[model samples]
Target: MAEDRSEQEPARRPGGRTARVRHRILEAAAELIARDGIGGLRYDQVAELAEVNKTSVYRNWPDRTALVADALATFSADVAPLRDSGDIDADLVDFLEAIAAALSSRQGRALLNVVGAAHDNPDLRAVVDDAIAQRLATLSQRIKAAIETGELPAVDSHLLVEMLSGPVHLLVSRGTRELTRADAQRITSIVLAGVRATAAQHTIALAGEHDGGKTPAARP
Candidate 1:
């Protein structure tokens, strides 16, 4: 009953089979966590859900925490912006929508379950903290890079990430209405408006300093 994907992989190569197997295990873990929370996640259950042997699960993951960490890491990677699309407006809209979709997906629910459990378990909390830190660091770098290229205004990257993601997280994490692509677009528009306004203010302030604190006269 093991779901050996060797034959199902697009490539008949060894690497293809390995990739397929890894995806299956990660997906199985994500689904189990979504359905039953972290307490219900066990190697046996993971093996059953993945349709693989328990030994196979152990051979690949080696530990429970390791499996959970890898699964969450994969989810985070999916949500991160790997490249800029040259159009800031379109790019930001797509970026936020991708985040909304990821966090609301079954895999995202599974990730949140692990996070919720970490609240009381110090050891588990440490592991989850490390995993999240890794996720955030990667994302923060991209935000910083945008600022450097003048695509974004100078602002706290972490704070910007929080502001960008908080609303969607609140609604979805609280079991409220799911965030839609339209909603994501609107949210990005608002945030960008604020950022542009702030950048303009900064420009005005610098101009005032250059002009000995006098307002420049408007051209007729």
Candidate 2:
């Protein structure tokens, strides 16, 4: 029997010419942002670099923040998401490697630059906040899924996100001269160990909660 067509998952949209143009615009914005920060991006300059008219940019993005936000979003979606292979350790390593790749990219550097400039500009703050919030929300969802699947214990997903990503943000913002892949992996391993410990604590607390405040027996 044929499966109900409506019940099947919808296919993803292919990246065609329209997607290519958007990619060009994002690349241009990233370059401009890196050079002059968020304040330096002009529709005219992006249009020129993207080989399109200002009207095209305006047509796609009604405001500067929208354009910048979309660029950040597009860049982020290009990276790999954390996969659950049913092994918590391996999944964490893969997630860390993907994060390292993102941080070392040009778009990632541009994001850091915009964040720095946004600190001084009230108007830019909303734009930066929205972008960061979207990414954090995605991270939280992934963490929650891991918990539901028993791959990880129930934890404060938001706080855990901060723990995992805070180091990368600080390193990028502090103008650290040398941030290598090996260094990133080493830091991630240490952080993952801490996360595992924290998860264990949460599991113990929950067990206590369910067992009328009695502590669980120590594991061998």
Q: lDDT per model, in order?
A: 0.75, 0.69
Candidate 1 scores a C-alpha RMSD against the true structure in Å of 5.4
Residue range with the least summed lDDT across 10 consecutive positions in model 2: 1-10
- For each candidate, give its TM-score against the true structure: 0.72, 0.68
Model 1 scores worst on lDDT over the 10 consecutive residues at 1-10
Tens-place lDDT per residue, model 1, 1-220, is 4356454446547666567677888899989988899899898988787777777788888878778877776765654564576566676667667666777788778877888998887766876666545545655776788888988889898887777777777777887787888888888789878877887787887888898979673332
| Candidate achieving the largest lDDT | 1
RMSD of each predicted structure: 5.4, 9.7
Q: After TM-score superposition, what is the CA distance of residue 192 in candidate 2 from its true location, in Å?
A: 3.8
- Tens digits of per-residue lDDT, candidate 2, 32-71, equal 8867778789999997988766666777787887777777
State the local distance difference test value for candidate 2: 0.69
